[model samples]
Target: MNHTLLRLIIPGVFLTLATGCVTSTVDEMVFDEPSEGIGDATVVILGRRHASDYETEPDFIECVGKHIAARDKSIEVIGELEFLNALYPWFEPRTAPLKPSDIDKLMLQRPVAQKLTALKTEYLIWIDGSTVRNDSAGSMACGIGPGGGGCFGFGTWSNDADYEATIWDFTDRAEVGRVNTKATGQSYMPAVVIPIPIIAPVQGTACDGIGEQLLQFLSGHY
Candidate 1:
């Protein structure tokens, strides 16, 4: 991969899932229900994964909490790490989605056939992202093709995904408001395109470019 090109292309564009950053059009929500004022609202930033990625970044929830603080300092925000370990081991498959046991295990709210309990969590902002994939003839054929030829297919593997930063009113995990965003990334033939045949730039560039869409969403809620 061409490191220089990637560095030039990807940085400053952050639609990153780990940071709860998205680059979507802002959807404004006026606090009409009045459970708690936005200024005085206290929140716990949560980063949920497919169970695969969560294990590596245990403090990911906290990372997002920092971004929230960047957005609006008026609200009292905190990152609770005490619950991180329990949430990592269990997860529902992407096909089936997360189950009640899964949520209970993560949230530490397990009780079989339990009666409803009201939660003091006035606002639970669930920050997560969806995956987007693009595979094309150029992507594969270029990879195998001669180096210079590879650069020609640079944009072919480009695929875009929309990031979602959802606000769930903890009354029943009801989704109140959300910001949606899209991040696009592509695998390019870097060795072929690079002036010096560097590999690191190629990989970094694609990953970096993916963040822009995420940053857009974050610009709004903050």
Candidate 2:
């Protein structure tokens, strides 16, 4: 092929295979029902890390929080680190409540209760789960010789993200609701002279899905 034709074809191929397909679903269940209005109450998103195998990603938690705050200007979201720091040792990995019931025990302490009141923490959302590579196939080989080098072959993999957000009403000291999100997608890497990656935004899709649902749940719109 001539240089001009080759250049045009390469760009077209890249454009066609630049992105992968992603599917996402979100569900919400309310137990105690949301308050009529959020008012000045503060919402905090925290990641659960007590599990032995996997801990929720902090960035994912932050992403959900940002999504909620951006979609609803009236709702306030406190940063995970800021909330943990403000509460100090009480919120540390060893002491943080593992379940909604545990919050009852933690709140029994006068200092903890006072601090939570000071922060105006009305709702606590605990997110748990991770994105994992489910399956992978194919491979690419690359080598360099005296003349030149190039990579050849194709690769593909699938990732699944499963996350659950449990919302707790701090003021009422009860479990208010839950939001669950699942996203799955396949990624492809095709190598001609170099590897071109078409990545699926599985985790990002999950984050966005849960964030929107949480916003509606908290706002009592659902």
Candidate 3:
């Protein structure tokens, strides 16, 4: 009700309506000559889960795939789970190829080759990394009284997302390129009488960056 309280509450209210800040960068490298077009072949995006500390989120992988497919109708994308289940033990974490060269060995198995052929899979993209909350500070307090119950205080946190996509050309049996994306953002929770959260889309930014880069890379425009 006082001028000082009004000043604090007004700023906090405005912040709640605003999204947190986010910064993202995408870098790509093409080792081999990219194909001019994909025609009817399919591209499969899979998340890497071999790390002991954290696994690449499945939703993130799906997000990138959908981004690509939505932007370019010519590109066909196969879902990560569908491709993994179709391949079975061959693409499992324990037995999956660790590098592009390793795919050569897998193709030696008749069944592996047959399945890939049946799917018309041309490009296999392996995405690895995760988004983690790095730092956080501040606090909130709440109390209930006869007058009313409310919460007050402020809090903020930072998030970083780093991911890399390794592109393998199944048709050529070689690695074509690599795309790396990094994004950082800060989220805030400002409370006056209620808590309003302003969340930063760190991982989503990373997905969009990598998806665009991959789209260009596959289209031979990168």
Ranking by TM-score: 3, 2, 1
RMSD of 1: 9.9
Residue 80 Cα positional deviation in candidate 1, in Å, after optimal superposition? 6.4
After superposition, candidate 3 runs with Cα above 4 Å error: 1-17, 33-35, 144-148, 220-222
- In the order shown, the candidates' Cα RMSDs to the true structure are 9.9, 4.5, 5.8
Which one wins on lDDT? 3
Task: Tell me the TM-score of each prediction against the true structure.
Answer: 0.43, 0.87, 0.88
Candidate 1 C-alpha lDDT tens digits along 1-222: 698878866753432311222332333343323433554445554555555542313343454555456555555554554323323333223422132233344445353113113212455555565444457334322334554343322323444454445565544445556554445444333234432111122212222332232233233342
Candidate 3's residue-wise lDDT over 5-25, tens digit each?
Answer: 999998988765678989998
lDDT of each: 0.41, 0.89, 0.90
Higher-scoring candidate on TM-score, 1 or 2: 2
Error of 3 at 72 (Å): 0.4
**Per-residue lDDT for 55-84 in model 2, tens only?**
899999999999988878888999999999
